[model samples]
Target chain A: MNAKTSSPIPPAEWIVAGMGLLVFTAVLGLMVWDAVAGDQSPPRITVEVDSITRSGDGHLLKFRARNDGGETAAEVVVEGELPASGGETETASATLDFLPAHSERKGGFFFKAQPERETVRLRASSFREP
Target chain B: MVRRGPKTLMSRRASATHKPAPRGTSRHFLRALARAFAGAIVFGLPLLMTMEMWWLGFHADRGRMALLFILSLPLLVGLSHYSGFEPTFGWVDDVVDTFVACAVGFVSSGVILLLFGLIEPGMAASEVIGKIGLQTLPASIGALLATGQFASPEEREADQKRFRKYQGELFLMMVGAIFLALSMAPTDEMMLIAYMMTPTHVLGLIFLSLVVMHAFVHAVESSGKAYVPSGTPFWSVFLRITIPGYVIALLISALILWAFERTDSCGPATLMGSVIVLGFPAAIGAGASRLII
Candidate 1:
């Protein structure tokens, strides 16, 4: 007993120091990990118009369904044109759940001139959302 | 008979007492001043230091621009010392010195750290580990505080009091980090919880850094006044504290800018504020403590 416990330093001090070092190393690793992993992706929308003719001729804008994000986009829509007359597109008329992240979902609508008699209103009623 | 070493009991008993208001004539009033004004001026400095940034950010919002410019006026009060780059006072100089020391420390330690990360198995593994370490500053600060890394006491009595008194500020810093990360994280996309650094963050970091470093440097410098042991160089101590912190700041800044550009209305303020508020002070505090000592 005398030989083994010769050192008079408090036993707790060593214990405290050891625990502190362990915690420090653990935390140092965590800081590095958090730096890489923390930021949650933000909501976004990217349009994919398969084809388009001319600005005057107008074109039907289509959306590839699927959020191109870590998480889903809350709501997304396309607005290709707005004629001077007629009713606009509404959510009831458009696609839903068409876009998922990392995949393409096809959604589309036609663009036609109002024929000069009445102007058609082409509002963004066609939407595919999160 | 047992040869009783120098009675450590006296020192232990002395430290046991937690008294009110720091003692004696060594400008303890200044400590009080720190406490009193900490809230008000701490409130004011971040708005000031980053005001130039704010002006650049929302030049469109004329009213907001005007408001920020006005709110941060008092922040420039300490400009003479900061701009002069002179260590006019003992403690004040320590603050500036720690900042410089940290920069030096960062460069040296970063090279070593980069090497550590590149060492085959450790590189991939450490990279994963490193990400975990970056969550919040408290965990690191808690470690540093626990390590007894702060500067040595000139008069042991006063130093102890100072440590006890400011422990709240440190704990607050810890709490602040959690709040900042939470608010900045995408809990709800509609968080308008003062996402800017608001000068509060900068001042808090500065004061906390100064406090911790002042204590640390004093401990190392004053204690070693008698003798400096082998293998412990001033530069290495400084670097050990600095490298991790400065690297964290730089990395956070880069990430903030990247995120800002990538996302809508995801400005640099939140990230900057979080770094300045959450990470900066504690890292600096811990760095100041360890390196100074």
Candidate 2:
């Protein structure tokens, strides 16, 4: 098998391969840890307005939905409510396909009335179990 | 690239076999690493583009993912023994090659997925790891097989000869089956199609899968006289290799489905249906592994 006479591997090759081994080990460790003792809470989604942009004839409320729990939330519905002075609540809603745990997804809601920073409220309305 | 068939195998036998490429230099090793990268992209791009695969990265069972990772190591080692990036002289060399290929797979997957916007800076470490880790196995196997793909036909023929034994052939079939099955198992269509099929459809598919698999392998085996004796009866080869190869494909299909959590909600009938459906592609892969890998 030429075991005795085989050439030594390049040092750089060894270093890269070692790094590879480290990568695999870290991934496997994280997965195992997650399976064993990682977070068990259901998906907790929170939405926040990122910016207000003026579109043609309307304003776009850009938001980021962040999932802080241990599970994935699918079909997450985020709503932005603008309470008008006439006891009417104008709601702009957007549905995110998924908000995975510890991850963030970007979405936007459009409203005809210019929303004030103080009265504009953003909330995750609902999410289904993924 | 030269297309190698039984003719090349036969022609190469009259001349002396070519020596395996030398290993150990940094430049040479780096070249092999580059080939590994190319291979990773070639084999892994389909799955990387699949949305279901991305979803499974975070939502699939962690234990099953871990199990698949653990199982891939031995599979990589065996693959390295046969056709690693650079020729290896010992088990240590093969192990080194295995790790190198894995690193190549991991890095390539990360880089490509990031470019696709599937992975980003703020993404959770678990999700990023899961996505890349799941892709590493197929890419690593591709990295290992890269050598054969790029080698001269004679070198590839020699490599094939190393694993020409019955057990070796079976192992190769399993690898091929797993490779093809992994690509298809993550899609919801596997279940959807299974759900759409009736008992008669399922039966027809099974019969068709067997016929296609046997026909392909038989053609390949017959073309290469070294693979089977010329006088061997059709039923003998059918029973000995084709049937067993299909069984391996089905088992691999089932394993991949279970690993991806596709079978979690399935009843026995549905599970069997999906396995058979996947078995079709896997069987094709197994039968044609000799040509591709």
* B17-72 per-residue lDDT for model 2 (tens digits): 64434566787787788888888888888888999988988887889999999999
- Regions of model 2 farther than 4 Å from truth: A1-5, B1-21
Off by over 4 Å in 1: A1-74, A77-130, B1-197, B209-275, B281-293
- Show the lowest summed lDDT stretch of 10 residues, model 2 chain B: B14-23
Q: What value does the TM-score of chain B take for model 1?
A: 0.25
Interface RMSD to the true structure, each candidate: 17.1, 1.5
Q: Against the true structure, what is each candidate's TM-score?
A: 0.24, 0.93
lDDT of 1 at B290: 23
**lDDT by residue (tens digit), candidate 1, B1-293:** 02212334544554468333333222432332233223222222232233222212211122222232222122111221222111123333323322222222222223433444421221223232222222112122222222122112323323333333233223322222222332233222212332644667567764664455434544534443212233466575445423433444334333333332322355566645444443443444343432221
- Interface RMSD (one decimal) of model 2: 1.5
Binned by DockQ into CAPRI classes (incorrect, acceptable, medium, high), candidate 2 is: medium
> Worst ten-residue run, lDDT, model 1 chain B?
B79-88
